[model samples]
Target: MEQPLPKSWSIHTRPEVIAKYEILERVGSGAYSDVYRARRLSDNLIVALKEVHDYQSAFREIEALQMLHNCPNIVVLHEYFWREDEDAVLVLEFLRTDLAAVIRDAKKKEGGIRVGEIKRWMLQILCGVDACHRNMIVHRDLKPGNLLVSDDGVLKLADFGQARILMEPGFDGDDDNHQLPVEQNTGYQENVTPPLDVVADAHSLPDQGFNKQVVEDTNREEYLRQLVELKAKRHAVDETDKETNINDGYSSCLATGTISDIDDDPLKSSYSYDAEEGGDGRNGALTSCVGTRWFRAPELLYGSTDYGLEVDLWSLGCIFSELLTLEPLFPGISDIDQLGRIINVLGNLTEEVWPSCCKLPDYKTISFAKIENPTGLEACLPNKSADEISIVKRLVCYNPASRATTMELLNDKYFDEEPLPLPVTELHVPLTKNNHDEDSPGGWHDYDDMGSDSDFGDFGHFKVENTGSGFSMQFS
Candidate 1:
């Protein structure tokens, strides 16, 4: 029998290591991974090969892609190879450019991505998000840069490093349990069914022997009163429990100094000029301090840990608007500035708009200049048609619950209106331009020349082009 190859592939072995594949060039890099455009030796077909230094992130991404690859709108994972040095490599379908690059290319053209093209891309994006949500996954980091476009015009959602699995409602394991893998849980035993009581569904209703008609007629008013009281009690209890979990989670993160302790903490603290020392009191999986600065949702801005898929919808709204203007809708320099930019466009968040805003962790601490009667979307997105503006209005809503869902957005009349969504094949985005040179410091083969025993080597040669909105670069 033939011996199986090891998961940890050595990077030091140049052309001889993965003899079947050839490294074409270095394409992109992030805090954790380096991306390369490579060719499969067998077929000579190109692929985007991402070498992730973070083992857990690679594991999370592989798991997510295993479930998400079936969706046509999502990027397809071709193969996964492991490295013995705590690194992982993933092979994915190559695309011409990402939506951010497409947007930039459009700026140089006569008429940027047209209305039909924008609508088409937006629909495809929504389809991808729908796929993730259907699989109980959330793409916490949805941005133009992560949305890849092919030369033939298909838009595929990529980058799952920050993705997460959402636990079902009423699931009793630690609400923050999603953040920790099963192996990491205390006293975790294999093949042991969770304690029935702990996993019981909270929303499941109880049965009664009484007839339905008799009960409704007799207990209508009384039933409503009881229901109201029950809801109030449940809300109070849930809030208190969630608050405790948040505090405990943050305390644990602060103590251990683990990178995953705080959501959005790493990138924000290092990059943002005015980011707080420790993130804004977000704890566990609920508070995803992910998403880029300009595309960040309003709930995240207010430090709400209970946010859900609507947060992504808010980002879609921003991206959709950007497709029209070729600029970020809210170009805030810092978190405070970002909030101010939002308030300037959408107006202040009052009890009437989002009744739960005042309850957010940072609500009491951060104060904004009150602006009466905020400007409408039409004023900000004057170039967009009425239907386009309507969709934008629904996406960037104050209350997360009130935001339009993926399916709802799909069914909206805006899609049915004039300038119908273009077919994917008809869409046009500029071809990718490789700005980095092969001979550059961080270029391809930087590690190949090093001794084979060397685990890793850093040859930093990344180039940045100011997009005027903020620094925009491709991340793997």
Candidate 2:
């Protein structure tokens, strides 16, 4: 017997979406979006409908996915519906599990994750990230939960809500077409007037309870008025000589909820980061407040907005570290503490390591005491071989320029050794579904709680001191 849809889910449903697919259940919910597992009415195929409430996140995800269409390692975006006043609903391919589940399940096994399995997961992630980087797209948020896996064992990169395009192919610094529009700057668009035929079709559809036409008209009018006021404010800022920082418009913290909080409650409120202007004449300055706290790069931790694809490389290193040890490399409670954990292991950030370190936005604002003997990567992965540690060292570093590129890591001899990367068909896919639901345990919402009980003594002892100025570290 078919189960009835919950009444609360009605808030996420739209006449157009209901017209095309049968909503089975709410699979995921976040600050600005809700994902539902639905079956297409046309072919009865299962799909995930991601209804995004934030305009900027929706636009960036749609644009990035469209640009990455047909990339095997990346998530597939089927189609989407966007109305002037309604939240954008994106139709996406549904995967059963993610890397987080794999890691979680591995912890229960006798010998832990197989060498071949680790190699395969790492390779797939590199392939997906390589594709994104080659296309000039920076997946600001990269974590175990975002790496979804199919039943056939193919891992695809998902959740591009925080992605940014540095430049298009053959993009010259002087090209105005590459620049983000004012609408993108303000995170809202003007009302888009639909075609007459589309309007007629919408009216022809049966109403569930309320009058659709009247409701849409009223919302559209009110939204247009608000947009006008926003545009006026934006124009005034543009005319000023003072530089405009993206942080001025919104909060730097993407979400106040911790990993534990998100795991216990998936519907927690979240925040968004705005892209700033100026970055070697590219689209714009990328936001530093991206990715989950644990996997965030050193540059991003110190608030470096003028970063590059290296940020993702740092995240890849963290993910790889977790794969090897089944534990997060640097699991810090807050951004300040996150840096402290890194500095505890990798030593202090100095000008000798990365010359441009002084240019970071919060470099001077946040300071840490020097470490006499930093616990190196080898200490973190105690039983792992030198090759494994070497691979990770190539990535998780203070110097963005020094970090290994995706292509370089892909070509590394690590994948060529015995117990080679398992073939996609032979790879073990966890049966647990990675629906972004409060009840399920394998999605972005659940990452914070993973390995929460692990001992941090392996990285050595370090105390985080709260200097009234900012956070600093004291090594014992």
The model with the greatest lDDT is 2
User: What is the per-residue lDDT of model 2 for residues 1-476, given as tens digits with 9 covering 90 to 100?
Assistant: 99865433343456667888899877676666777788999999988888777767777787777767656787877878776556677788888678877887776678888887787788778868876775567887788878888888888888887777754211111222332232212112222221111111111122221123422565445544543543344334333332333322222333434232223221222233334334444344445666677887887766655556678889999999999998789877556667778998999898888766765666765566778899999999999988999999999998776787765665577877776666666667777843334565443444543221223343346576676777644434
Q: Model 1 Cα displacement at 371 (Å)? A: 1.4
- How do all models score by TM-score? 0.68, 0.73
Model 1 TM-score on a 0 to 1 scale: 0.68
What stretches of model 1 exceed 4 Å from their correct place?
A: 1-17, 169-284, 433-476
lDDT for each residue of candidate 1 in 1-476, tens digit (9 for 90 to 100): 99875544344353332675688766665456667778988899988777777655666676677676556777877776663443666778887577776776676689888877787777778767766755556666677767877787777778787566655311111222233241211122332232111111101111111112322343444534543443354345334545333421221001111122222111111111111211343333354345565677876666555555566778888888888887768765445556666887788877788766766655654556568767767888876677778888888878765677665565566665657666666677665533223454532112111111101112112234465444422111
- Would you list the clashing residue pairs of candidate 1? 7-82, 8-83, 8-84, 9-83
Model 1, global lDDT: 0.56
